[model samples]
Target chain A: MSFKVSEDVAVCGGRLLKLSHFSQVIGTIMNVNVYLPKQYYSQTDNKVIPAVYYLSGLTCSPQNASEKAFWPFQADKYGFAVVFPDTSPRGGDVPGDPEGSWDFGVGAGFYVNATQKPYDKHYQMYDYIHKELPTSLDEYFSNGSRLDFVDNVAITGHSMGGFGALAGFLKNYDANRYKSCSAFAPIVNPIKVPWGRKAFGGYLGADEEAWKGYDPSELVKKVSNRGNDRILIHQGTKDPFLESNLKPELLLEASKGTSWEGKIDLKLVDGFDHSYYFVSSFVPEHAAFHAKNLGLI
Target chain B: MSFKVSEDVAVCGGRLLKLSHFSQVIGTIMNVNVYLPKQYYSQTDNKVIPAVYYLSGLTCSPQNASEKAFWPFQADKYGFAVVFPDTSPRGGDVPGDPEGSWDFGVGAGFYVNATQKPYDKHYQMYDYIHKELPTSLDEYFSNGSRLDFVDNVAITGHSMGGFGALAGFLKNYDANRYKSCSAFAPIVNPIKVPWGRKAFGGYLGADEEAWKGYDPSELVKKVSNRGNDRILIHQGTKDPFLESNLKPELLLEASKGTSWEGKIDLKLVDGFDHSYYFVSSFVPEHAAFHAKNLGLI
Candidate 1:
């Protein structure tokens, strides 16, 4: 699929390219933002630049993280590109939550391949984000450029997007699709959370086994983590969703006897919330972690 | 007389306290956001933390710069507090532009004390920002603290607010009110520009003499500069308003042959715009400049 350049605004030593492309997987026009670090423009070396895909929380577009997450500075600091993918396929015809609640409808795709009726027509976001989008971007930018959008990439997200990152990373762990993975106040065990249950029930036709494939708590048990691989996670204590929506402790408990035990670096920060303020506050640490894993440091 | 706390958000190594207070100067409850850096909470030393007052441009509230400017990191890095003040007094009863244009109404006070009818009753932003707001904050945080909101302070802003900073800095030059002054895409020669002419005509009632009092280009000639005092400025060459609304060159030209000659550090950044992305891109440099002037360096 071809891409259209909507806006290329200069931000923090580089440019933030806002692009909209026709996604073959989702059968809709998907919006995504890519920040190319200053190194890309000033590069004398012929090295392929790795990418970090950031999935946003509920009620978010690619613009939220692109504007507030402050990732451009971090991307410029260590030579890597950042990709901000939209939460879901949004249009008038696209089926949303019938109740008009923010948690269930559009902007809350939960990053899953839908099997349910009307949603299945345009809600193939899991394939759109993790597979089709990256391949298309690689093809779009492959004009004598060595920007690797497929391999040597890191993944991170906030809340629902955080759940997406973990599930995607673990599902592709054997193939080593993502070199590094991190989350900011993510819903680690989506299978046990209300947000996950509703989304899974709506999109996957209430199939509990289908839900397990996208749940990090369940996926961690099935996917064997190779030796010395760590997944970084930060959870805010003051986050209102900690008790009912995002019980991060469940993921740790599920990983107790597995190879993923002690490999998940879950840091509980004090007095922070589930906002972009929290996501940006710790982006430097996450960037450095990804930089190390991507061989940039 | 008393401040009301609305939302206290944790951001970057600090907390953003969103406050509203009834102001005698403006005759309304004014909104302000103050960012108390991490050092404010974790201080063992009795060091007086300096403050930086950031004035927003037209049609912006306290939230615009607070969210997009990315100043919290630099404030924490250099141990200073940042204050974001609303552009103008806004309410339904308060008078706005009869034409309902965004340029000269509600959000466009131009940081001047209004003398005209229908606006003078509530649009005293000049006194509200520079004098009353600081005094109120100092009184609010005067419990065994060393946060200096009055004396050891820096001033900076973008576009309209940039002009405000320059005008305020120059008007109080003899008193040495601010330790440092900087701007991003400011309208320097307000007397000659259309936006300034309209604002001045509306706020000051057709008095060109009164307009010169707030014009930085005119103030440069009237106010004798002290030795070794420099004003730092960054203007985006690609700013859409550079030709019509913001003629930064006139300020430098007005400073020629005066005591302020060669003291203005005006940098024309390449490919930048009149957006917060441009402001944040250069915040590190401005922060360092202010930090040095505030004696933090």
Candidate 2:
């Protein structure tokens, strides 16, 4: 878990840090982009802002959300930390495309702790993100952030990462660990979708019962789903993956049309695609939505 | 040339056209993004506005400039047409990189009309951009555009495209082709620079004489240096390539210290890199710069 403060960019008084981490989880060194909003320092009396961890989709890294998705301005205004970790580790330790066709190899960390042979050595994203990664970030921003705020964390993501956030939270539901949660265009059930099936079959080795542990719909159904009293979900109406991979309705079905369904606020945005343009067009609102619920003001 | 008008995003009443072309010169089918400002309809009854073509650098397509670069507002103010052509052709008959790499194979046209081996069959960028490309664009804009305004074209690009714009204006030297020129962090002298040497040597063979035909420094030495007069070059002082590849001094030297010395208006931006962050920061000014010169305002 050792890292050097190699590069720093002055962004709205806070710093955008790029840290290189060699992990047993992802095997190779991972580059994570952490955004410490200006409020972390301006408060002066040492107040840690509530934090949000944003995970990108397959074929994406921490850099994708920070640079392309326009997350900082919203983070700066709302006063929160945004942690973006790479999808998968790079270099030799992690196995990549023997046949170099985009997706599935380097940038694709399916969020499941890998159980298959070769991948098991490196692919431990579930643990890396949910457990160890946050522990490290807790220290990284502590210099400028207050200890109270770090404890008040919210986890959310897009596509695969969205699915990851749900599974991660449901699996580790010690209400004390995280204060709230949400997702933008999440893959609700991986076992049911093509992308999820392929990734799950390859990584987890075809155990249907075991697969339920990683599926949000299944996880939500079994457990009484509790985090924030309200879970905000934003999905683009025109996303190509909407009808298939991201049937957010599944989460609704799993909530079993009960009180938990009332807890999930689903927003359908118009004329948006699966691309970053779609995410960026609505990132500002999502940040504010989380901030308001967290009472960050 | 039979492009089926796939997607059109209208900004300021001017349609950004995505056209398909079998670029015999570049040896593939190319996608070009053209922006027609509001003035195309507002200015004079049937008044056609002059145009400026913007070429992007490595790993980028025409869409990159138009989408996130924030060029629409500036284009509307200028009342001119801005064209963005794909860096290179893809999935066509063109024999591009049997082994793909980001630099030489695709998305990195270097804007040079290739001459070596497999590249020569389709990599005729010089002809495609300077000749075939504009002919159709002139026809598309129609009316006076097909007549006078379209002919009064200025060329500019960032990085590799900057080098392209310089070479296009120089070698072609069609008084009717490009009326003026400028660049954004362009690779000025390829022969003297590592990137240029690798690309030119591979594409044009070891012919220094032929390379000269493409080098801005060499081209400037032969032609009217101040032709870039009233031209503006916006570069970041912190640009990583400032010393190595984009030696503005080489361009400064090529003009015999006379042409663009100060008149060309070299702006050295502080605390910026060669990345889009730097480009996005100053793209508005560049649009305005060309718009003023093109008389679209």
Candidate 3:
């Protein structure tokens, strides 16, 4: 479970440490990029730095968000670190989309523990991201360090990863795992979407109940929002996938009359797309939100 | 002289309009990205917005800097439009590096008007960037528009384009074309380096006199610095090509006893490299500097 340092690049007022480590849950090597803010290096006092975990969308690696998201500057501003986890487990031996499509294969793991044949062995990204990777990172960096990668943390993502963030936040809402949650053009209701249907059908083996455990719309009704927590969401109107793949309105509809009613702050931005340009434009706002929740404000 | 609007992406508080037009000088289609600040769309009065032209380094298109430089936010912050010009004229018939190398080929035009065979036909980047592009863009957008792409503008670049900016700024010093000049890890004294030697020899023939016209070190002594103008430059200490290809000290040495002596602010930052990460880190400072020079402050 020891992490291996691959490349350390200096960005903004921080350093982006590209790391790879062995994952016991997936039984494969995983790549992750962590941006340690300037405070971590120029620490004069022992202050625990909170972390914001950013899960990327489909067909994205750690480098995509690390390079384009412009998160390092905000992390430096707020005295927090940003952790970018890879989208999917990748290798030559891994089974990809049968039709050689981009949406269902190597780059698109959908962040789920596959219970099906051929994919069950190595496609355990659900556990890898939520449970194992954070514990391993905490253990690796716990050498008299005060960087909290586990407890005092927040979660955010884009598109499918946005679905992951909402699902993870809702599933662990009872335990109060994540301090905050936000998403940019997220696939909120995945079970009813085409991309989610294929991924769920392939990974979870056609079980509707199994799919509910990973769907944010279903999780909202199961978990109670006691803190009156506000989950921020920004969906671009010009996003090409809004009508077909990401029906965010379903998520708001699902939370109706529940404990989480009126708690989801969904902001429909004007003239923006489903690209990183849209994600990065609102990153400062999300950073401020996360910083406030993480007690750095 | 007409521009074709290919892709208009909304980034930050502005619109990144990707345009392509036939260059009369280079005799080829060239791609350029223009980021019109929010002020342009929300104009309530006759406010003339200035432009900043950013040239890319070797093996770069307009997209590289457009995607990674994080200039849109700064452009919006300072109320300035940013023009990202292509490194060189590119096509299937256009000749590339003889060795099929990256640093001396199509992407590595070095922004010089070549006088050599084959390359001379399409390698008129110096004129295309400094003359044709600005004029065409100005004419194209002159329909009840307040965007100034010609007179009140600044120039900045990275690596080879750094040399281009310094050369262009100094060459047009008497005309007062650009209001400000800056570079990030630029090739200061290309005449004394291998990259410069190869490009000069191939494009300008073996005439050292012709090479001097395009060299920043040589231009500093020839052109007079009027208004106590300062050329801001940031060189990374950890940049792999600092000593060999980019001899920024040589430019300083050549500027000794000249009008530009003690005027070039060459800052050697620690532990940085020749990447967009390095450039984007210092863009805010450069943006503020240009804002002051362009009277935006």
User: Which prediction has the highest lDDT against the true structure?
Assistant: 1
Pitting candidate 2 against candidate 3, the one with the higher lDDT is 3
lDDT of 3 at B268: 92
Q: How do the residues A97-162 of candidate 2 rate in per-residue lDDT, one tens digit apiece? A: 455754566777777788987777888888888777877766654564463334678778888888
Error of 3 at B183 (Å): 0.3
Give each prediction's DockQ, rounded to 2 decimals.
Answer: 0.83, 0.09, 0.84
Considering the two chains of model 2, state its CAPRI-style docking category: incorrect
TM-scores of the candidates are 0.99, 0.69, 0.99
Tell me the TM-score of model 3: 0.99
Candidate 3 docking category? high
- Residue-wise C-alpha lDDT for candidate 3, range A1-297, written one tens digit per residue: 788899888888889999999888888789999999998898584679999999999999999988888998899999999999998888857889998998886878888999998889889988988899889989998998889999999999999889989988888888888999999999998889999999999999977889989999999898888866899999999999999999889999999999888999999998899998899899999999999999998
Pitting candidate 2 against candidate 3, the one with the higher DockQ is 3
Model 1 agreement with the true structure over A222-252: per-residue lDDT tens digits: 9998899999999999999999989999999
Candidate 3 residue runs with Cα over 4 Å from true position:
none
- lDDT per residue for candidate 2 within B123-214, as digits (tens), equals 77777788878876666545445223347788888899888988887776645467677788988889999888878887899888888888
* Ordered list by DockQ, greatest first: 3, 1, 2
Tell me the tens digit of each residue's lDDT in model 3 across B134-191: 9999999999899999999999999999999999998998999999999998998888
